[model samples]
Target: MGTSVGPSAGLSPKYQRLIQRTLRIERQPKLELQNERQQKKNTKSLVSDLDGKLSSLQSQLSTLTDTTSSPFDGRNASAAEGTEGFSVSADETASTGSYSLAVNRLASEDGRVSQTFDADKSNLSDFFTNNGAQTFSVDVSTPTDSNPDARTSIDVTVDSDGTNNKEVLSDIQSAIDSAFQSAVDDGTLSADQRPSASVINPTSGTARLSLRSQQTGYQGRLSFSDSSNNLLSELQVNADQIADDTQGGEITEVGTDEASSKLTSEFELNGLTFTRNSNEVTDAVDGVTMNLEEANGTASSFEVTADEEGAQSVVKNFVDRVNEVITFLNEKTNVNPENGERGELADDSTFRRLSRQLRTDATRPVEGQPEGLNTLADIGIEANRDGTLKLTDEDALRTAVRENQGALKDLFAGPDGVATRMKERVDQYADTGGLLDSRQDSIDSSIDRIDDRINGLDERLQRREQQLREQYAEVESTIRSLASQQQSISQRLF
Candidate 1:
């Protein structure tokens, strides 16, 4: 039992040629394994690409299916001409009606400015003789309650670090913000109750401390008071000019606050009166927020209507994603132009089914919608000859949405809608542990097996090569000894 092949009885055996032939035969399996590995890699990549496109299509479909979001219930609003002081947002709850808005006085924040000083040169030592806790309080009066009576007044104390004027002002601002935030945290004051503080250096080359009510309108009127007169006076803020809620006044300009007493914003809508401390009123209308931009006593008309931009965007995205998936399927399944090589999943049946399913879902008519609104075609979306979805007429779609939004909504995202069905179908191919996942796992496993066989073959080939070399070396030595013996015997005979 010889372990190796025939060794030449001549000068030496042709071991190189034998090893080459044997190795060539043995490496066939390894070569095949490598090719299979590459094919599997390409297949996995194809599946992965399909998965991403399908997932995106599903997400877009989800947006259309979630009817509770009122995806089609968009709102648009506009103020009457010559109106500069207000804006509005109309939602699902807003009616298709116009309102005559008369702003008796636009709500303004209780605001005040500091007397001026030189920012670079001034220090806290000039104002406060002692670097201790100095207290400042904010008083707010609403229709229900007035502050400075403890509950409505937010008191904050600033601890002077005995630093420069800039640091002093900054510390004061920080302390005020912290106090309000603490109140909000403790449920003492609402988040909106916070006051704002800033250091203003006007052209006077002097720095002044500016303080204002964080809130707007009459209730947000600010009144500044210091238990220590030195605090307000040194800061150069006028404590005497507090705004009184009883006197309603309008500012001719934006920044000029004549008094410390801030005026509450007063406005009338549809002959109904409304009063708020701030110009920005959230509760004025149901599902509608009112921002009193200006107080024009004259009637300013605003109309609330549906905003179609959001719904239109969602619709556009759905079409684009459908086309993307179609393009991917077309390219992957077709042969490459440059090399004439087919794609990894060119004959993939599962991918073919997935592509056909998506197109069918998009073209299918939604159940329960009107005959004119049930299908994607009815909503101005049509399939082209190339099997791609196209919004054929944007104006028609927009008109459809504007006129019968409910019908369009039902067709796209209703219980038996096109988007919903498409999403569900996509899930079969792209979801976790779904068809694509199974396919990818199978590919990865094949690659793993090929790698194992290739490694084993590598070890076997190395051993076989060494054995051939050793056997041929021994054959060469034997031939050398035989030739020497024959030559010596012939010489003696002669």
Candidate 2:
């Protein structure tokens, strides 16, 4: 018998796979589209980064452009040692000057304490009718500039079954607090018009109830009377006790002058005497607040001046933001020196032009400014070699902020000022519907189109692959027919 060829002959499966892979590799359009998509994505990322930097720059610009309540208007109050009678603070509206203060009296809050009671032995229910529930009223008077005698009253009902004096006092204290707090919540009484109640056990055997005003000075004075029961008289904290105490009686009165009953803060500012209802006086001096701590009756010297450091901080922060935006633009638009590859935004004309314009805006001199305080260079901010800004001369900036504030304002906030012009330019590119947003939208659309094209290419590859498989199937059939014929011929010849 002669040897016969098998039907599984000709092209091997491994070679067929190699040929299909070669054909797929030659489809260059899909690979090119993928590369383009990556480039666009990088460009979009750079655009987002630049947009964030521009927004930060705009916020810093707004602080400089604001006409009212700016850092330029800041003021500071300074006092020497041994002037411990009062602490002072000045605002933007305060004038730069020296002030002399002498404190005669510091305002105080009104308070009252009941006579001591033997907690274990005393039966506080006797104040009521044989330990029955008793209802009494509390009157709080908070005087104000508009109303000298604003009084509010709240009635509290206490039910105590205990014979211990401390426990009964605690019940009364809780009732009083609950009543006033409820009045405050219902808008019947303001918070300052409410009084605080507490029961203090100074000794193990003795306990006393104390009530204090929420406010300082005479505005917080309090008085108690019996509403349905003689609670205040029995507690020995009524107006009669207060009067007798004020007239050299045993019950001591806190926060009230024995001679005049004038619970006010009396101090002399700038050699002129003035009195305020509260120790924290704000209106006595324009834009200056004086907080009285002691009644030393000694003069203290305080100086109010422009806040140079505050103004300098504002300027430095503005410069830092400007540098950030400028540096980002430069980096995104730069070209690599080694391989000559363009950066993410190298071809973006808007960002390229913005980079140059920012440098010009940051360095150019403002019109109508004086010789020494005209430009950013004059006020200590200078451009670096790469076009970023730096605060180089702090002393010059400080002098400009303190002595030449008007000219400095003109340099940063005027019509043709550096900060003003830079802000306008950045807004055109970063604001809503601005150039950067439009560019990003256009890039997104292009990416979407690329995705569609890639999908079409994938479908075309699949169809081509199917056609190649059919052609290879025909070749396999022909090989099988030849192998069967050879086997038949060998048998016939034999």
Candidate 3:
């Protein structure tokens, strides 16, 4: 057979080379698989860290939402029971009894009564007797013609040469204008306070400056004086002259004895006032006391006891809290700070379901009320399309709070009230073994097991790689020894 030196003889070398190359490639894939497994482990750890932070934030948000949205605040029925459907009587008053009755009235300033009728003999006599020797200074100058057709007029100037006399007319006008502006700004000025100022220059060349005080029964006239207290102007009159002037004059009624009362029950504890036959109460005068009478001819002895303000405040605070919760949830669940992306919580099935449940709870009807009392709509609270609460009608809310406070209380304080229900639900989900806790625990356990498995795999892979390296080294040594023998033989043969 001549030692069969065919292709089979060379195939051994090629087959060994192929096996070595295949081993190298297979080792590379094992290393790559190890890297991929490690990368997966790192990703899982990152997800766990993020989930922990998110769970913590959600817990905090849940606490805040519960605190701010508590429907139990101001739900106490004590104040309502004491205030509603109650009538008070002034006859129940004792001289020193510590009795308090809330009366509704208009708020006004305090001041002297408005003056009227300056021509009465007794009034004029009293005015001049007490106001004699009061002086005023008058300086009249010829008016420069602004219009040619207009009659020649006289102008009055005060201390024209003195340093303090600069723009005296302008200063006076400014003062008057400022006073009017102030009255307008205060929102309390009445018609009686709208007084006008005028400067008169009689043909006698005497310039008279007068301030007609907006008051009734003026017992004295005004006196004008110089800076040095010297009398500048005064009206001289005897008792006989005053009496004759009073007798000759027409009886003019300048002011009336109208009673002014305002009703302030809506806004404040202050009672309303009734002004008899006159609108003087609307004047800008401060602290003018008219009779404080009720519209029904009764004394100010009405008692309106209700928790209206407190209830409304509670509802408002609750609505505000709920909105805050919504905002917080939206931020936490949907928004990603890095990429500006929405978070898992933003449209989370659990969160949306809970929000809808809360809304239904809030708007649920009161028990024993056939017409379905105590809805959010009744108190002017409306829900937006985004599942948030809004206050739309403040007046209507106030009225509902005032009138149906009991129903309002029951709506939130009843067995199925929003507060109670929310507390139960939140507590259930937030408990140690609750939904969030269970999920987190499960994830933690999974991570722990995965870490254990990865650690075991790492140990096994290290041992396997060491053993494979030793085996390859032994194989290379044997192969190299055999090749050396073959080379030596060939060299000897050559």
For each of the candidates, the C-alpha root-mean-square deviation to the true structure, in angstroms, is 7.9, 5.7, 18.4
lDDT of 2: 0.79
> How close to the true structure is residue 92 of candidate 1, measured as C-alpha lDDT?
72
Measured by TM-score, the strongest candidate is: 2
lDDT per residue (tens digit) for residues 1-494 in model 1:
12444442332336667767887997898899898889889888878888898899888888888756767777777788778767877667766668888877866565666554455564665555554678877665433335322337778887766456666777777887787778779977766666677766655455556666666654455555674645765554544443232221122122333232236677888998777656777777766777887777777788876666777788899999999998798777766779989755678877766667777888987878887888988878999765689988787778876889888888877777888788788888778998889999998999899899889988888887767666776877777799999999999999
In angstroms, give how far residue 226 of model 1 lies from its true place. 12
Model 1 regions more than 4 Å off: 1-14, 80-83, 111-212, 221-262, 271-273, 334-343
As a whole number from 0 to 100, the lDDT of residue 344 in candidate 3 is 43
Per-residue alpha-carbon lDDT of candidate 3 for residues 318-437, written as tens digits (9 for 90 to 100): 676666655555554555668878654554566556556656665666555425454667667888876678989888766655566445555555565555555566555555566656
C-alpha RMSD of candidate 2: 5.7
Q: Candidates 1 and 2: which is better by lDDT?
A: 2
Clashing pairs in 2: none
lDDT of 2 by residue, 193-282 (tens): 788889877788888778777766655566655646566666665544453311211133444443344566788888898877688999
- Candidate 1, residue 368: Cα displacement in angstroms equals 1.5
lDDT of the candidates, in the order given: 0.72, 0.79, 0.41
Where does model 3 exceed 4 Å of error? 1-317, 320-356, 363-366, 369-372
